[model samples]
Target: MAETVAARLLARLREWGVEQVFGYPGDGINGIVAAFEEADDEPRFIQSRHEEMAAFEAVGYAKFSGRPGVCVATSGPGAIHLLNGLYDAKLDHVPVVAIVGQTARAAMGGHYQQEVDLQALFKDVASEYLAEVNVPEQLPNAVDRAFRTALARRAPTALIIPADVQELDYSAPEHVFRQVPSGPPDAPSSVVVPAEDQLARAAAVVNAGSRVAILIGQGARGAADEVMQVAETTGAGVAKALLGKDVLSDDLPYVTGSIGLLGTRASYELMRDCDTLLIVGSSFPYTQFLPDFGQARAVQIDLDGRMAGMRYPTEVNLVGDAGATLRALIPLLRPVTDRSWRGRVEESVADWWSTVERQAMVDASPVNPMRIVHELSLRIPDDAIVTADSGSSTNWYARLLRMRGGMRGSLSGTLATMGAGVPYAIGAKFACPDRPVVALVGDGAMQMNGLAELMTVTRYQDRWTDRRLVVCVFHNNDLNQVTWELRALGGAPKFEESQTLPDIDYAAAARGFGVDGVNVSSPDELGDAWDHALTADGPVLLDVRCDPEVPPIPPHATFEQVKETTEALLKGDPNAWRILVQGVKAKAQEFVPGRR
Candidate 1:
């Protein structure tokens, strides 16, 4: 049989070493579906419950695998449904390639059924590279460019294929005028390093300061040792951006936990007291959390020159790979003789951890949300991959959970979207089937889209070598994050109509789909429940009834924020008394002599 464009596309993806393409079936992609049957699934088509979930799964796969994740969908609505997930990839700077079916060439402009302008829809999200393949000759170059552009730019790219073009017989571009030919699928590798003069200048700034603080993000993942060496040489306290939570192990004495709003007091203190700042591979946008402007001299090292000096007024912006750049700068640095700064940082970190443990142990009406993550921190496997959702639970995930050994963790960092935890875990499972994957999500997110993705989990559970995927749902019956935002940010009380969530038995829902389920309404059951789910033979969903009133207080809460919360409570918050009691107990831990 003559190779169709659809068959050629699949073959090219296989050649690029793509094991699977996360997507959904539709009539517009009939040719591609048929080719999958004929090709015997060389690159498996992992069908997701929704097109958005498919795109998120691709993003998650790319994030964990360090390769371009591929996702496909049908024309019009299916293509539109992929926007949010694609945006998540774009904002987070993940490499993903999306292939979408379009209307037949003849019916595109006629406004045929399920026909829409796909190129326009995808332009912003896949701004790095967007192509429409109208001819069979355009197939190879389009697919290849999509992958290359996505990898090079570290952003999402798109390929729009008309239905007719996909069904046409594949043909190679002739060696003639105006013909384009593509090279092999291999991407050229190189280590980028900044000029030696820039490295010397950066080192000079570090050498001049008596106290230094270092901040790292996902880009520093490969240079963990180099970052540690820099910290040791400069006597700097290392703080991680939320996305770089696993870049350095929290077990390090001078390693402060996450920075910014969902940050530790130690990190806040590190930033407040430091005179020199070194930021590597991170574009953390919250400038207020950084050392006050002009209070310190800062240097930023990033792969993209465009993002180098945007966050803070960095004195030297080094555009190079983090590992290479740090390696170059290390030789120029002078080891600090004054150990007082290092000692102070270590002391603060120790005090902060003790405060965190006490805060987690504070009493609540049902279960304290902080304790949920604290328990997981106690027993999480060294090699596990953890994913979190965007909600009040995120505060616990950012502060309480500790990363160590080969453990990796991530979420929708820039996008901050919910309903991604489950799909991200699913993607992580596919990326590293041997490693255990756990998703920390809120009950609101569970009801939003996670409940449906459980079927995706059950279907593919047998394919994973180690079938241990734990979805721990923080089953607090409220839109807890927004509730707090209303009180703290807007100075408004929680409106029940908008804040209340319909309570559902998430465990029963999981059980109906043939996955194990555990319900924990008491804090006492958390430890055992986590153990059971973590060691399960297949996917397990833990429905934990957490206390919604337990405040996700900022490490350094402002006076205005406290005043606003007080005002909101005085204006008749339904859980006002309980909220005050829990907040006091949680905050009081910091002031306790032994605990602090």
Candidate 2:
């Protein structure tokens, strides 16, 4: 049998050491599907419930595995469906390669079915690299470059393969003129370090500050030890961006939790008080949460020169790999003799955690949503991979949960997209099949797509060596995040038609999909439910009914924000009284005598 373009593409993927491709089936890629069958599922095709889920799963796999994830889809709508997840990857700086089938070459411009111009559709999302494989000869270079560009730029790339071209006999590019040939699939590795002068300047700035603050993002994952060494030398308080939450353990007394609107008071205070700032591998955009401009002498270390020095007015911008650059810069840094700043930061961190505990335990109607994650934080295994969807659940996940040991966590950090929690967990499971995975999701997002992804979990559970995937749904029956945003930001009451969600028994849905399902209405049941789900032989779903009135107030709520909330409540919020009560109770935790 003659090798086809589809077969050749799969072979290239195998050569690149790709273990899996997350995608859904469609007639546009009928040739590739047949080739997959013929290849005996080498570089296995992991089918997702939807194209968007496939892209998100790829993003998750890439995020956890430190490799470029690949997702495939059919023409037109399937390709379109991949945009949101691809955008998530692009915004979060995750490397992903999307291979989508396009309309048959002959039918492309005739206004035939699914004949959308994919190049235009994918232009912005895959701006790093986008190509159409018009012939078998274009296959190698196109696919290889897509992978290479994705990794090099740390962004999404795309390849559009025409349906008819996928069936053509494979042909390698000749070594003659006008033919573009590609070498074997191999990623060149190198250590990037900033120039000696730049490192010295960065060190000088760090050594000069009395109260130093260090901010880290996903880019600092590999340089944890180096970062800690720098922190100790400078007596700096460390603050993590949401994407970099797992970079440093929260147990570190000087490590302030996430820094932003959904941040810890310790982190907010850390930024507000620092005389100098060192941003490592994070382009955390909320400049308002950072030290006031011109108040602190700042230094930034980033691998991408393009992204460095854009977020803040840094005195020195060291363009290098975080681990290598920090290692080089360490020798030039002078140790701080006074430890008062470090002591203050540590004290604040401890007090913040105490306040978090008090808030999580605050009373609610049925259950406080914070307790769901707070309980999980207590029981989650040291090696668990936790994922959270975007919602009010994110607030608890950000503040309540502590990342320690080998635990890894991620979500749609930059894009802040819903419906990513379950798929990201599914991808994490595949990326590290031996590790336990947990997904914290909201009721709105669960209904949007999570309920369907459960089937995908039940289908693949046996493949995992440690099948302890738990999806905990915050069943608050409201678009809780947006509801709060409407009140706090827009100064508008929660419009029932827009904010309310239809109640669904998520646990029942899980059971129907052949997974264990537990329903918890009382706060007392959260702990036992988590224990059972965490130790289950297969995947489990905890449908936890929680209070929607519980507000996810910012750590440092401004007077204007409080005023807007009052205005919104006065303007006829449905649960105005309960909301006020919950907000007061939750916020009061910060001022409690010993807790503060």
Candidate 3:
């Protein structure tokens, strides 16, 4: 009796610490599935309804557990479906390993049912791309390399196992396990920025300026102290992007809150009042909040090349890793004895915050989205992990939601695609079962992919992790925000009739999958429903009807966008106002729980 090549490979994957491999089974990868079944190895295989769910589940697992998440897909479309999750992982810098089964060696270059250039299709999305050659011995190395690249680069990797090679016989190597470093990658550039003079000059501006501000982004993830040091040095107020929220403590003295479309007025006003703005790791796309002209200069630093000057022109653009760059800039910054800079920004933030309390969060409507948003934040426990779907949810939660220590979130800032929240939430929960997990999604965005994840969560609950997470759905019927955006851009708003979705009963949809589902329409029912679901032992969902027209538009969107949407909506020109249908009437959803 001889062992097949697939058995040997699956054994190696098990040794690599993959606990549960997510994917749909097929003839192309039958040998590997059988190997996974037979091998006395680490990961057990789970069949998903769709290949996208497989990759997405793995993504959730990788993000929460801080390990390499694994997924297996057959050739052609199965492999292609992995692309979106792979892209999400690559862009967001999560480690994921995808095993894609390829066509047989005999069928090389021939059109096959489940055969395509798997490597080529995946190459763009993976940090490392590999295909097993005819030689069976070469597979372990490719797999090993892919595993290494995914974790080391903090991105996704794809391995294509040719169908014929799966059955080839080979000797298994000794010690199949390898552990990659879990820390953030080394700072991109070694040559430090010699900003002694610039730092001093900037420090002087900070010292004298009436107001100073800090904009933090993804690069600041691990540099909380360093970022705080910069803010304290100049008494600059801090505002973090959706991804950078975890880095700075919410109670930090100089922190002014968040800014964006869903931004807090306090943070927005603090930024507007700042005489000098120091951007740390953030190249946020919204330029409306940036200072039009401050006697104070702007200093921006990042590891990525694209972020430099992507928005407003930078007074100083220092290209280096964020952690290292900030350390270098620290010594150059002069300490300011006077607290004027801090005082001014703080006052502005306070005044603006008062306005929000009076307006957005004050005595409000029966359909107030802010009321739902604020109330949910209060109920979510500190250790829960959350992922947000696109549209107003992304904006509202990014700016308004408050996360304490131990709570983290997943961001799709780069692609900003809809439906990612559902998959990302599911993926994160799979990775950290002990912690509660939540997926906050608008009704439209949830429909994009939430239905696919229902079975996966139901299967895993009480069986694998036993932790029941929450999927909070916002049922906002109109495409209100998108319609408005279209109107802003010289487009008509007839998209109202064409793109608006009928209100869906999300709780009913979840109930169909054997998960707990609660529908709440009013304030009182909403709180009671959330309380009941929070105590349940399995995955539960709370579907609430959030107001569709509540998302605050960015203060600075062009007049053209405003005009077009108005004409389109008023004139009944759906075609002319088509762009406005993109994200209108989005619901804001949130979850408060640790993941699997």
Candidate 4:
């Protein structure tokens, strides 16, 4: 018999290029952790107080490194916790591999301690799942599949090995592992280019149109320069979704900016005013914000076939990679050097930015959410990484914050999960301690996962600088923003307007946990608090009270929008009916209007 099963797995993991990971140890996983300890070339292991953090740290590592990040945990709660982070990875298109230790095979159904069905718990959340019932022979294949599926779809996958398997010794040659395949080219070579006439038709749409807007999603990052060239030649501008913000700089003359709530005013105005909107490489949601017949004609060019016609109707839905499709289409355009159309749209964008100076400005209000974000944005080192909690803070950051060339913003912007910001902030600081990291949270979300990290941060602060983690809480009392939106969506209002939260000092709660605490009741105190945290010797907490009535992520609904959208949809009023039809026409004339 060989010495131990966990030792062999550890050896193989080192061979698979794993360097650092996070997890918590337990009784069943003793052999596994011991095996980890016994290994000569041991990977660096960071301890997580909760299994959830263990999984999320892997998510952060994968996002920052663009590689598969690994996490480990014991059975029961450990294996069950792979859901949230795994789901986060899948939806965000990140690759993560979770190695969960299961209870002994014999003890599985006998009400054994820490025994649970990890396979069933993770089935829906994972892209691929493998259970190692036997050791040695099957282990390599299972590990390979976990990595392959995780990377293959750019999502999270799992490998669950029983504790008994980790203890059983099976001798085998160590050279059995094979390389993870680089994967096939996304689109097949058989996907032939459009015929010359089809290319000419798209080109005519490009050349004949005076004002064309190119909308890039996450699918457009690689072909950014080429898209810029097309816009340069064809009197067109660019509009990107929030995920596509990195495709071009916010300052680019041809690039009008992003088009969603996190977008710039100029980009939305451009998309709303163009003759034609050319969507490239994005499956962005929020169809309501897109240009319709009255605004602009939309011609989408996307790689994923499923995304076509999912949102706005397409005038000419071109199916191909953004770069490849643009390469094919540029040749067909009858080179027209007219600058009037492109120049005018850029002018409109400039005009929009001029009027939007109300954003991110410091005000004399006792507590201003925008001012707090603005001050942090200004004082925090330009390299600082920020994560926005899904609350008023999220809304505020989406409007007021800017990401420089090298800066990264972490949030589950797609799925919009509430508690991710705090955990992601902790994980980011753990990975990149040098960059100033601030986790901005609304009180509702901070309390969800905030306590889990107090121990970890306190213990690590002695060794690592306490300044790395600055937890800022917006103590607005109630779930004011969400309840407000619920009311906007036809739900009941949250009591009267003159309401607030119960009295309990959150800064005091943080102080009790051995973290730095600063209570900010006035805007005068915000800059000093943030500055203190930035310069402090450990992790700090800043609890600032932002009035609940401050405007949300997007400005509060205009009277026109409220009457046009709400009354028409909710009220039985005849006047509301006309606005509803008009709203539909405003959003859907591109696809098919006046017909549901």
Model 3 lDDT-worst window of ten: 587-596
Candidate 3 per-residue lDDT, tens place, 1-596, comes to 79888887776776676678889888888888878767753477766778887887787678667788899998888898888777877777778889888889889788867778765787688746555545666667777777877766668888888888888886544444542223222222343453566555645555555567789886777677888888887777898876676667555556766767656655766667777777877867777777775444677777665677677666767666677777877876767777976876666555543444333443223445655656767677778788887776666566556777778876576667677776676677667767777787877777777776787778767644637678888777755456455555556543656558787788898999988889887766767776776677888888887655553555334466566556656776534332234223221111112110
Over all chains combined, what TM-score does candidate 4 have? Answer: 0.80
RMSD values for the candidates in order, in angstroms, are 0.8, 0.8, 6.6, 7.5
Clash count list over all predictions: 0, 0, 39, 4
**Tens digits of per-residue lDDT for model 4 on 432-480?**
7676678888877766776567667776665444356788888877665
Which pairs, if any, clash in model 4?
A: 217-282, 466-538, 466-539, 467-538
Whole-model Cα lDDT per candidate?
A: 0.93, 0.94, 0.69, 0.68
Better of 3 and 4 by TM-score: 3
- lDDT, residue 191, model 4: 36
Using all chains and alpha carbons, the TM-scores for the candidates as numbered come to 0.99, 0.99, 0.84, 0.80
Pairs that collide, model 1: none
* Model 2: how far residue 345 lies from native, Å: 0.3
Model 3 C-alpha RMSD vs. true structure (Å) is 6.6
The superposed Cα distance between candidate 1 and the true structure at residue 328, in angstroms, equals 0.5
Model 3, TM vs. native: 0.84
